[model samples]
Target: MITGKNYIGSQLKAAGTKIYKTINPQLNIENPWSFIEATPEEINEAVALANDAFKIYKNYPAQKKADFLNAIAEEILALGDELLEVYCSESGYPKGRAEGERGRTIFQLRTFANMLTEGSWLEATIDTSIPDRLPLPKDDLRKMLVPLGPVVVFGSSNFPFAFSTAGGDTASALAAGCPVIVKSHSMHIGTGEMVASAVIKAAKKNNIPEGVFSNLIGSGVTLGTSLVKHPLVKAVGFTGSINGGRALFDLASQRPEPIPVFAEMGSINPVVILPDALEKNSKKWAAAYAGSITLGTGQFCTNPGLLLGIKGEKLNQFIDQLAEEIEKIAPSCMLHPSIKADFNNGKEKIQSQNGVSTVAEYKGEIAPNYAPQTILTVDGKTFLENPALSHEVFGPFSIIVQCKNNEELLTIINKLDGQLTGTIIAEPMELSNYNAVVDALQNRVGRLIFNGVPTGVEVCASMIHGGPYPASSDSRFTAVGIHAVKRWVRPFSYQNWPDELLPSALQNKNPLNITRTVNDIITNKPI
Candidate 1:
C-alpha cells in the first residue's frame, strides 16, 4: 500500500528524485516505506488543479459535500487496523492513542458533514426591498458566506490522524466548499499516505471533483513554500511549531495577493493555582497537575507547560508534592529522536539560566526516544525577565513559577503572549476576589478553564482552539469545531438579484429549511 509517490488529485506521481522513509521512533530505526517528495512542477500542478476544481466544487450542492465528507470518514474506518499499526510505527505513540486519534479524525469529518446538512453554516441574511418608502427606496439585499477558492493544509507531526491528513483544518476547508492541498508532515508521512488513500477513494466514490483534495509528500521546506506562494492558493491552515507556522504565514503574506494563514502554532498554556485553592487541597492539586503536565508525553499544544502560584507555605507544599508526584510516573517515548533531543536541550537551557532551580528530575533510564518527566522552578521575576523561559518545551516537561505575591502573579499573566488555553484553580468564590487577574487571563487566552487541565480539546461547536499571535496566526478563527469553516469563507452580498439566481439556502422557497434572518427576523419561512 506504500506507493512512495505523491497523490496529486486522483493520480499518483513520483517525479522527484529525493526519497525519504518514515522512522520507527520506538525502535530507533527507519521503516521500509519510502516516499518521493513532490517537485516544484508537481506543486504547481496540484495548486492549478485545485483552482480548477474550485470552479465546480465551490458551487456544488451542500448534500453532495456532506456525502463526500461522510464517505471519507467511512473509508478511513474501513482502513481499520492497518492504518492504526502504521500510525504507531511512524510515531512512538501507543496503540490506544493511535486508536483514539483516529476516532477524533473520523468524528471531525462527521461533525462537519452534519453541520453542512443543517445548512445554518451558510449564515444567510436577507432584507426585502421597500419600494414605496416615503423618504427613499430600499433595494432587496442578501448576504451569505461563500468559499474562498483553494486552500493549503499543513498536517501536524504530533497528531497523525486527528490533526494530520484528515484533521480539523482539512475537514473544515472542504466543508466550506474550498478545494484542499495537504502538505504532509515528514515525521508521519507513511500514516499521511495511508489516510490520503482513503480521502482519494472517498472523493472518487462520491464523484467529487478530482482536485478537491491532494496530498503532497515532502520532507523539506520546498514543497510547502511553493504551495503557499502559489497564486491560486487562497487560504492556508497549519498545526505545528511556531517557527514553521510563522514561516508559512510570512510566505503567504509576502505574496502580491496576500492570503489568510490560520496557523495554530504553539502555546505554553498556563494554570494559576490561587493561594486559597492551594491551602484547601495542595496535594490533590499537585497530583492532578503532574498527570496534566505529562499527559500525552506533553506533546499537546494545550499541555500545561507553565504553572503559576503565590509564594507562601501552602504554595511550597504544593510545589514539593507536585515534584514528587511527577517523579513516580514512568517515562514515555516521544514521536521522534529529534523531539526528545530538543526536549532535553530545553530542559538544560532552563536549568542553566541564572536564578532558575531544578525542582525535580527523573533520573530513571529511559527507552529509545523516551522523554523524562521533569519539572523546574524559577522566581516570577526571573521568568518575566527571561523570554526564553516562556517558550514551549514541547515534551513531557513543565516549569513552575513561584510569584512573590498575588500582584506579581497577576502581572505575569498580563505579560504573557496569546495562549490556546489558560486555567484558574481557585477555591469557592476565589475568582470573584481576583477580578483583575481573571480579566488579564481572559485577554491572553482563547479559552479559560475554571478548574481543569488544558489537555484534550473537544471536537464540538463551542471549542475555540486559536489565540493571538504565536498561539495562532489569526485568533479570529478557530482550528477546531464547526465555526472553523469561517476561515476559508468570506461574506458575499447580492443586491436586487432574482430568486432563481440565488443559492438554494437564500432562495424564496426556503428549500433547505435552514434558519435564516429575513426582514430583520430569524425564521425558517419562505418570503
Candidate 2:
C-alpha cells in the first residue's frame, strides 16, 4: 500500500522515498525516514495542476469557494494528533507552539472564508452616469478586486504551520479564488505534507476543481525557480532569508510579465533606549532586552538583534545586567546545523570588526546544532562605520551600540536598513523630545512600537508585516493579517457593462449588498 508517508493526490512516491529526517540540536541526533521529499517532476505537475484548476476555480461562486476554504480548516483541525506529532518531531519546537500555530492556521483559513462569504473584501466601487453633463455624458464605471492567476507561495522554515503549506498566503489566495502552488520548506516537510493532504481533501469534498492547491518539496531552488518562472504564475508569496527572497524577487521581476513578489525578509529589530528611560529602569530594561534577544534561540525574525543606548552609567549598568542575565540562561538547540555554523560565523565576523568588544562570550559547551547565546558591544562610531554589523545573525546573539549623544543615536538609526519593527524604550519626558526619532524610525520600519517587545506579531486587520526593501520585497502589501489577501488580488474596472453581465459586487441592483463607493459616496445600495 506504500502507506508509510508519501505524496498525496497523484500517488507519486518520492525518489528513494527517504529524504525526510529530524535534526534535534539538543541531542545532536539526525533521525531519518520520518517522511519523504516530493521530486522535481512532482513539483512541476503540482504547478501544472494548479494552473489547470485555475480555469474553473477562479470562476467558482464565492460561497462555494468559502465552503472549500472552511472545509480545509476543519479537516486540518481534524488531523489533530497526527499534525502535532509530525510538527514536533520535525522542528523540535514545543507542543505549545505547535498547537498555537495549528490554531493560527485554522483561524487564518476561516478568516479568509469569512471574508469571502461576506463578499465585501472585493471593495466594489460604482459610479453611476452623470446624465446632465454639458459637454459629454458619463456612463457608469465600476471597479472591484479580482483574483490574480496561479500564485506561487514559498513557505517559511521558522513558521511551518502558520506561514507554511496552507498558511496565510495560500489561504488568502484560495479565498480570493486564486490557485496556489506551495514550495514547501525543507525543514518541516512532514507538516507541509499533512496540511497539503487536508487542503486536497477539502478541495475534493467541496467539488473544488483539481489543482486549486498543490504542494511541492525540494531542498534546492530548482523547483521554486521553475514555478516562479512559469509563464502561468501571476504572483508570489515568500517568507525567508533576505538572500533567498531576493533571488526569487529578481526572478519574478525579470519575467516577461513582471509579477508581484511579497517577500518578508531580514530584520535586526533595533530597540532604542532613551537616556531617561534607561536611568529610571536600567535593570528592568536590561532583563527585558536579554530575554527578547535570546527568545526562541534568537530564531524569530523580529528578535532584537541590535540595541542603541547613550553612553552613561545607566547604559553601562544595563549592559552589565544584560550580560549577567544572558549568560545565566541555559543554552538551547537551534533549528539546524547549517544555521548554527552560520550563526557562529556571523558572531565571529562581528567580533573581528574593529572596535567591537565581547560583552559576554558564552563559554559553555553547545550541543551539536545548538547555539549559545552571546552579547557583544560596540561604540556608535564603530557601528556607523561598519554597515556589515547590521546583517542578521539568525541565532541567539545581540549587539549593544553605545552612542555619545542623541544625534549619534539618530544618525545610527537613520543609517540602518529597513526592519520589521523598531522599538523605543522611553520615559514620558524623554519621549516628548524624541519626535524626530519617531519620525526617522517610522520611515525605516513598517511597524513602530512604544515600550514593548517586538517578538510577538498580532494578526489583525491593521497589522503591517512588510517593510521597505530588505525587510520585505514589497511594503505596500503585508505578509500577515487580514490585509495579506491584497497580495493575491488585483483591481479590475468595468465601464458601461450590461447590468445583468456585471459581477454581483458591481451590478446596479447590488445583489451582494456589499459596501461600495457610489458617486464617491460609501453605501450598500444599488447604483
Which candidate number has the best TM-score?
A: 1
lDDT of 2: 0.83
Angstrom error at residue 429, model 1: 1.7
- Highest-scoring model, lDDT: 1
Q: How many Å off is the CA of 83 in candidate 2?
A: 1.7
Q: List the residue pairs that clash in candidate 1.
A: none
Q: Which run of 10 residues does model 1 get worst, by summed lDDT? A: 218-227
Clashing pairs in 2: none
Q: Give the TM-score of candidate 2.
A: 0.95
How well is each residue in 1-527 modelled by candidate 2, as lDDT tens digits? 11224342434456635355656554566645455666656666766777888888888888898899899999898888878977876676778888998998888888888888777788898888887887999888889998888998888878889898999999998888898888878777767888888887888888887777777766547777888888888999999898999999999889999898899999999999888887888888888877888877888989999999999898998899999988988877677677788999999998899999999867888667667888999999988988988888998888999999989999999999999999999988778898998899999999999998898888888888889889999888788777899998889999888889987888888887778888889888776
- The backbone clash count of each candidate, in order, is 0, 0
Give lDDT: candidate 2, residue 384. Answer: 91
> Residue 442 error for model 1, in Å?
0.4
Cα RMSD (angstroms) for every candidate in the order listed: 0.9, 2.1
